[model samples]
Target chain A: MVAQIVFIIILLGAVYLFGKNVAKVRRNILLGRDTDRSDRPAERWAIMTKVALGQTKMVKRPIAAVMHFFIYVGFVIINLEVLEIMIDGIFGSHRIFSKPLGSLYGLLIGGFEVLALLVLVSCVVFLARRNILKLKRFSGTEMTAWPKSDANYILTIEILLMTAFLTMNAADYKLQLLHFGHYATAGSFPISGFIAPLLPSGPGALAGIERGCWWFHIIGILAFLNYLPYSKHFHILLAFPNVYYSNLKPKGEFTDMASVTNEVKAMLDPSFVPEPAEVSRFGVKDVTDLTWKNLMEAYTCTECGRCTSVCPANITGKLLSPRKIMMDTRDRLVEVGNNIDKHGKDYTDDKTLLDNYITREELWACTTCNACTEACPVNINPLEIITEMRRYVVMEESQAPASLNNMFGNMENNGAPWKYSQADRLNWAASDKVD
Target chain B: MEQKIPTMAEMAAEGNEPEILFWVGCAGSFDERAQKITRNICKILHHVGISYAVLGTEESCTGDPAKRAGNEFLFQMQAMVNIEVLNGYNIKKIVTGCPHCFNTIRNEYPGLGGTYEVIHHTQLIQGLIDEGKLKAEGGESFKGRKITFHDPCYLGRGNNVYEAPRAALEILDTELVEMKRCKSNGLCCGAGGAQMFKEPEKGNKDINDERMLDVIETGASVIASGCPFCMTMLTDGVKHMEKEQEIKVLDIAEITVRANGL
Candidate 1:
């Protein structure tokens, strides 16, 4: 009776904390401007399935894709065991399914053991790639202490959780071997059975070890769930929605702000002049100006640097790294979110998202090539953010580079980006050398 | 081919309807190198007997460069004026030698109420050949000469028309030599997203120079593309490498014109 009460309190506490964190993140994403993506439900569903659930783009890099596939699939399937763990924890029961499940329990446990082992192996390989090999993507200027450690922390957590799970199973199987009270000869531990003999034999010690692993495993999962909102691992949950909301229009299409376009239409009119439309700030000035989908995109970045690695601007050694662009957006988003949390909705601080974090140099370096968008495994569009920020710099501040100003001036005066008049546009056709 | 290239107003004055409006983009209308490609496309269009008319002086910039440079105001101004002209002429179809213009018209104009069936010249040439309106005679057989095709990022990736340009070039009676990065994975010729209108910021190497190295490695005697901006950039890249005589940077329209003995 006491044990069930204790379990209920701990479980309720974890549940409450996890719910609050998720709510905070949802609120943070909703703080951005509204964008209507309600059209084409069928297409969005297909995209979510193919990119996120199917992992179609992930396989572009064959080796890493294979390793990640094992980890991803293992993580998903292993969570089924968590359902039983929760039920067992809440009721203070041991091996609840072993009686009715018969050998099915053995098969299930055996499958989980195999997956757990694969997960552990992939985690070590990933750690080696990041730490010992010091892969270029894993150790750049952008990969600084917190981001780097965040990656390691999640991996280490997975390793610990899996170890505890297997250790618990091993101890339980040993108790079954000893034919202890109420211990059934049920589970077939393929991987953990070998380790069972090494564990301490006393009934009290065995119960202690099993009970300890059980508590640690459940608590570790809850902690990991809450940590997601603050880390790049948020992609694990947000990738589906991110790809679903990806801009499906032809990449060349730039989004026209309705306010700007409405005023622009009136400007094109010859005769009638109404009062000037109340123009708000052009482009993005803060996280608030960015669309909700853009915020979701920032949250969905995996920081894998695939986008950065494939970026032409980055490859050619430009200041633009698509990975850094996303990281900065996420960082600023967190900053703004915290500010709002402290000061309420209408808060005004001296800082803005534009210059406070992402720089003008980084925004200008992008060629808008769409390479970053294409290479993203989860369909995070960093190019969209860069272009949006560039829009901010150009339209809001009118502080474009001199050459761009010259081009814009030419476009305005000559109706083309060259200095020649529109009348002379056909002069190249009259050249005798052309024939 | 002394063809009568009527302007939209001239065609309307004659009380005739053109099959398509040939949008002679700013680059094709002004740039020295791009002009040659424009003439070649015109020759092929005439040979195929497609009833097409040029907007001539009536056409303004498509505002692609301006829009890409983040000047939405300038872009909309240019777009609204051009849309008025096209709609006044009741132009239903637009064919252009520039992918930048093609993309802006097909994608952007609809939001501001200008809509037309737009085609790149490569797609036009491929369509003509496919419809039996034009044919290749193998007279200017490029059998012995190696040729490679560069996918313009705007035409290939931006618009997803990779196969059409390749189909047009495949008429050469010899297979195209593939660059290390070709088709969807193709590199930009360093002139996209208004990068052509201004100089790129400082970097270790220019994208065009890196792209040129890909072209040089293929040992192609001719580099064919669909977009005029790419033609200009690749032509400059060829000169920078001092391989002007060794390799020719020509549009696929030019290739088809020469291949068909037009």
Candidate 2:
């Protein structure tokens, strides 16, 4: 009864904290400008199914895909065992489903055991890939101490949880063999049976080990759930919604600015009266100026660096790493969110996403090649943020590069990006043919 | 030799509309090297007997560079001016020799109310080959020489027109090769997003120099391109590496004209 009370208290505390963090994150994301992404429900659903649920893009790298497949499947399948553990914890019953389920319970637990082993092995390999092999993508400039440690911590936690689960079953299996009280012959432990021989052959020791593991597994999972909202691992939940609202237009299309359109219309027409509205900013200088979709994209970034690895500018040793763009956005957003939490919703920090986190060199180095967008597993568009920041720099601040200023001037006056006159447009046709 | 390319004004005066409007972009009009590509595009249209009219003085910038360079006000102004002229003519079909012009007019112009059937010149040549209007049988033979196609970011990943350009080249007698990063994975030529007009930001190496390594890896003697900007960058890349004698950077239309004897 005392154990059940403690379990209930811990579970509720974890749930409440997790709920608070989720609410904070949602509020942070909604702080951005409004844009409708509710159109074409059927198409969005199809894409969500293919990209997030099916993990189709993950398979682009076959080795990592296969390993990730193991971990993902294991995480899902092992949740069934977690359900059993939850019930057992609440009722203070040992394997309560054993009587009703009988043979089927053994089969299911046996399958979960196999998956737990795979999850354990995969996590170790992932850890080694990060720490041992030191994959270039994982050790990017943006992946400082905290991000790197966060990844290592998650992998280590998973490894420990899987170990506990298997060992718990092994201890339980031994207790059942001795026909101990409440330790009914329920689960068929194919893996734990191998481990059973190694454990101490004593009933009291076995019971303590089983109970200790049960508490550890449940508590670890609850802690992991709470950890997700504050970590890059938040992608596990956000990837679905992020991909559903993907920009389905042709990659070449840059969205026309309505503010610019209204201004241009008034300039072009003598009789036209522009709509009286709030003084609209040209583009995103900070998170608040960005669309909600862009904010959600920042939250959904996995920091996998698939984007940075394929970036043309980053490939040539340029300052523009697409992964870093997403990281900086998220970091700045988190800071803004913290400020809001402490100083109320209308708080201002005077620092923007531009100049503080992302540099001008990084912004200009981008070729606007959509490689980052194509390479993102969750369909996050870093180019959108880069372009929006560029717009703010040029239109709001009037700080465009000298060469680009020349090009704009020529386009304004000569009707082209050069000093040549529009009257000479037909000169190419009249010129002598090259042999 | 003068080619007498008819202007939209002349076509309208004759109470007729050409089959397509040849959008002579700024580079095609002014740049000395890009002018040769513009002439070949006109030659191909004339040889295939497809009636096309140039917008001539009426054509203005499509605002691709300005928009990309973060100057939205200038871009929209340029777009509106071009849209007004294009809508005034009621142009139904348009073709462009430059991928930047092709992409901007096709995708961006429609939102600004300048809708038309826009296609890159490579796609037009591919269609001609498909319909048996053009053949590579009679022109300069590249049978023994190795050729490779550099997918322009605008036309390939930007618009998903990867196959059309390759189809135009596949019709040739030359052996076609591929860079390791081709199609959707093609690297930028350090020329898009108004980067052509400006020097690149400080980096370990220029993007074109890095891309040239990919070209060199393929060991292709002839690099076929579809964008004027890409042509300039690749040609400069060849000079940068001093492989001008070993490698020739030719526009896809230029290659088409050489192969089809147009």
Candidate 3:
């Protein structure tokens, strides 16, 4: 009865946490203003194939890739075991895993145990990679807050879960031995066979210990479920869908000027009125301006700093950092979310956060070359945001690189960006013979 | 009622039916050598049993450069007027030596309800060659002199025609070497998107200069291009780099005309 009460409390807490996260994510999806470019069926399948099934992006770093893949597969396969463990804990009947497929369940459990061990080993290597080896590739990258500590904590918890799993298996095997009244099958768990001799040889003690280990295993899994949302492990749940819906468009296609009227009309009418009211201007001035996918991109950033590594501006001694662009956007979103939470809908101080977080020069320095977006393992489209900001700078503020002003003027008068007269347009035809 | 612009399909349907609607784009009608090249293409078409007409001053800008510069309103207005004038002649199948005009009338005009089946002079010339309507006279190789093709953005990337011009070059006895970033990823000639009109942004390298260096690296004595803008910019780059005597810039039409012994 006490174990039942503890299990109920932990499960309820996990349910509440997961529900809250879902609600938050759903709100972002609905309210975020990104354009839906997922109309093509081929594109959807391609994204699923490349990102979800293939795990193409994550495997750029092989060690972490291997670790993450096993953990991911193990977590998925262990679901049945999790349900069986819960059912056994709630009822006195451990008949869930003891059915016709009992041997198959044992094999599955064994497979998961092996994978868990591999995952645990890989996690240690990752920790050593971050903390001890400290290669430059890992350094100055977007290391999460308390990443080392979090990794160590998650690793410890994983080891404990697996240890508890094996312990429960040992106890079950002993109970099976006691039930069948045979020492021949006792060798299945050699350590448990040794442990069986040390424990009370009666059925009552074995049953009590079995219930205790079941509670430990069930409670450990429930706690992991409850803690999933708040940790970096949240990516284990998020990255799959995030990768599956990754942008498949050519990099240059920016958010089609929501309405082309302002962009279209700005050409001929030298005195053309700027349509500030009807037109949705270019820059992502706030979180609301970002598309749901862009917001998702912020959340999905693993902070691997691959973007920062390939950013030409960053390499050429410029202040522009692509990693910081994602980080700042994420920080700003959280800041806004907190403000909204505290002050309700009247949160108006987001300007200071935007101004301090992203510099205008950094925004303008981007060449829209897509090198950073190409390099990013998470499929983050940083260039899209940069181009949108460029549009804002050019359209809303009437501010552009001074060179572009001359180009615009040439285009206005000569039908070309050059200052040459319109008469020169057909100069290339001089070599041809007219009828 | 406001005048209606004929679509490219409607225009292409009138091929060989009307006198050629000579599209004297802003460059060919104005620049001296470009006009000469245009005259040469017309002459070649005339010699090959194809009758053509010239729109002359009736032709207006295709508005490609303006559109590229994010000035779509002017582009529409210019396209509307050009469409009206072409429709006034009830003419279709507009021919142009300018790839920008070809691309604009062929690709972008449909957005403004002015679709036309536009073909570049090189494409038309290649057709003439394939149909046995035109024949080249040269078999002698221009030994020790190599030629390279500079792909104009509008002709190559914008419209996906990379082969016909090279085929013309092959007949000219010129050794064809490709630039590293030729065809789709080909560097711009510092002319498209109205870039020719304005100063290039502050970069250590010019796009045209970079492209010219690519051409020079191929050891080509002549750089061939379909678009006049590419011809002008590359010629200027070659000159600026003091390779003027060693290198020459020729339009694909000019080369084709010469190859056919026209």
Candidate 4:
């Protein structure tokens, strides 16, 4: 009875902590401006089905895709086992499902064992890709310290959790064979039975080992749930909603600025004097200026570096990595969130997302080709952020590159980007043909 | 050589409304190489007997480069001016040989109150073929030859105009072959997003040079494109590769004129 009380308390405490962290992340994302993405329902459903549930974009890289699919599918399937574990923890019962479900429980256990092994193998491959292969996209300055370490840490934890589950199953199987009290002779441990011989032989030894593995696995899982909000692994929970709320317009369309449209509206109508609305800012200066969708996109990034890998600027040795752009936005937003949390609502940070995190050189390097947005498996639009910053630099600060200045000057003076006047526009028609 | 091209001002003074207004973009107006593409488009229009007048002196840049270069204010100023002139003439149903101008007019101009039925020259030429108005007479120059159409970014990926240019090319007797990256996946000619106005940042290679390799590998002697900016970049690329004499980079309008013996 004491053990049951202790188990319930610990489980509830972990659940409360996990819930708190998730709320903290939710609050941080809500710090940005509002953006209405509720227009299209049928389109969003189709995209969510293809991207998150169907894993359509994942298969672009076949070998890695299959490995990731194994782990992804396996993890989802094994989550059922976790529900059973959590129920057992609450009621102080062992293998409760075995009695009610009968022989079906053995089949489920066998499937879980096979899936756990697959997950372990895939985790090993992921570790190898990150550590051994040192893929160029994964080795850049953006991925230098904590992000890289965080990746390895998550993979290691997953590896440990899978190992513990297998070992615990194996020990329990051995104990059952010895006719121990309350040790049900159920659960076909196909892969873990191999571990039975490796464990020490006596019922007390096996019981101790089994209980240790079980406790460690459950504790590690709870810790992992809490850790997700702080890591890129949060994409596991966020991908579905992120892809579902994607911008459904044609990829070629650039949305007109609401302020620009309003200003244009006033210009077109000569009759009514418009109200002096808050002098609207042209473009984003920081995370507060970006839409909630943009903030959510930054949060959903898996740090897979797929966007950076295919980025023309990064591939051509330019400073702009679309993945890094997303990272900097998230970092700056987190900084602002922390400041506001500590110092009420009036807190201000000395740095902004423009020059403090992402540089002018990085912004200028982008070709705005939509490659990064297209390449994103979860539909993150790093280009939108880049363009918004460029808008700030040009409209708010009136600072643009020299050549662009020349182009803008000509556009203002002569209705064209070139110095030649519109008077000579038709000169080509009257000019002698070279041929 | 003076073709007596009617301006919108002239057509309006005579109380005439043209079926379409030709928006001669900056490149088509001033650039020497692009002038030929402008001429071919005009010839095809005249041959089809479609009443089209140019903005001429009234025609100015579409402010596409300014908008793309992050000068929204300048872009709006220029767009409003052009919209005034176009609206003053009460013109509608415009066509242009440049995809940049087509994209800006079709997609961007409506926000500033300048809306019209904008058609690309390739699409116009494709329509004329379908209408049985402009027929391709084989053996003029490019009969029984392999001709590859380079999809302009603004026309292809930018506005979902992949089929019209290819359909226009189908009117010719030339065999059509595709590069490794063509159509929606077509590589840029290093010119979109105002990149044409500035030098590329230091890299191992130029985008146009890389795209040229795709063109060269296809073994198509005649490189056809639908945008004037693409013509200039790919022409420079062919010159850089020293394949100028062998591989001729012609606009799709130029091909249409050649095939029809216009």
Candidate 3, which CAPRI tier?
Answer: incorrect
Pick the DockQ winner: 2
CA lDDT, candidate 3, residue B89: 63
TM-score of each: 0.95, 0.98, 0.64, 0.91
| Best TM-score among the predictions, by candidate number | 2
Q: Which 10-residue window of candidate 1 chain B scores lowest in summed lDDT?
A: B1-10
Model 3 per-residue lDDT tens digits across residues A1-435: 776667677777777887887676556444468567567767777776777667786665677678877766766776777877667556634545656565665566667556656665666676677678875555443444664466567767876776666565666677786664322232234333334555565667766665676677777777777666445556566676676677664443233342554545555456777657544544556666777887777777666677776554554445667877876766677667667768986767836323577776676555443557766765777766665555555555666556667756665566554467765443443333332
Clashing pairs in 2: none
State the displacement of the C-alpha of residue A400, model 4, in Å, after optimal TM-score superposition: 0.4
In model 4 chain A, which range of ten residues has the least summed lDDT?
A249-258
As for candidate 1, its clashing pairs are none
Per-residue CA lDDT of model 3 for B63-96, tens digit only, reads: 6654544444455667767777777666668788
Return the candidate ranking by DockQ, descending. Answer: 2, 1, 4, 3
Interface DockQ of each model = 0.60, 0.76, 0.12, 0.51
Error of 2 at A106 (Å): 2.8
lDDT of 2: 0.90
True contacts kept of 1: 0.52
Error of 1 at B23 (Å): 1.2
Report how far residue A189 has shifted in candidate 4, in Å.
3.8
- What is residue B249's positional error in candidate 1, in angstroms? 2.4
Better of 1 and 2 by TM-score: 2
lDDT of 4 by residue, B5-123 (tens): 87888888899999999888999888888888888888888888889899888877887876776677667767777898899999779998798889888888897789999989989
